[model samples]
Target: MDKIVLKNMAFYGYHGNLESEKSQGQRFFVDVEIKTDLTKPGQTDVLEDSINYVEVYDMVASIMTGESCNLLEHVGALIADSLYQHFQGIIGLSVAVRKPSVPIAGVLDYVEVVTTRGQI
Candidate 1:
């Protein structure tokens, strides 16, 4: 199996538990890893044979700005679901979504949600 990774994909949106967070908006960081059989793409050496990350980025960006998902967990799961459905040969995935501007009182970097697809 080969792994396709997309890291530090940043986005800004309104996903949070606090009132200020929803109204003010915040930054979210994402890291996604998709695991799949690579024997075919490895042999073909074609961009179309393998997963194209630019399309993946576009998909993620579209989702982040599209709807009113209230939880990062739900959003993360949505991404995993989309990848599994949209891209073939995807056997498993790890999606981590981080909220960097959470409205907590103390000093903190971010809160995050990690989701997996077709993972045992």
Candidate 2:
């Protein structure tokens, strides 16, 4: 199967378990891999034959910017579920939600939660 990869898409969101996090908001980076047969799209070279990148980005942006979730898991799951519902061609997908600013008292890069759905 072929794949459509959207990596390190950034968005500002107020989602976290901490009240400070919710109030202050933070940057969330999402990586999505949509698995599907790209043979038709590759051969035809038509937009309709392939998944629309803009649409997918918008969907991800909406979820990231909308409503607050206590965990990155929920955010990832929401993105995966929404994409599956809107795009029937998606055989499977994996969503990785990254939180750059964690409240932990340690030095680290970031925290990420990944959610996968369907048969990849």
Question: 68-90 in candidate 1: lDDT tens per residue?
Answer: 57889899988989988999878
TM-score for candidate 2: 0.96
Candidate 2, backbone clash total = 0
User: Best by TM-score, which number?
Assistant: 2
Error of 1 at 46 (Å): 1.1
For each candidate, the alpha-carbon lDDT, in order, equals 0.84, 0.93
Model 2 stretches astray by more than 4 angstroms: none
Clash count, one per candidate: 0, 0
**Model 2, C-alpha of 92: deviation from truth (Å):** 0.9
For candidate 2, lDDT tens digit of each residue in 60-97?
Answer: 99999999999998899899999999986899999999
Report each candidate's C-alpha RMSD, comma-separated, in the order given: 1.5, 0.8
For model 2, the local distance difference test gives: 0.93
What's the true lDDT of residue 64 in model 2? 98
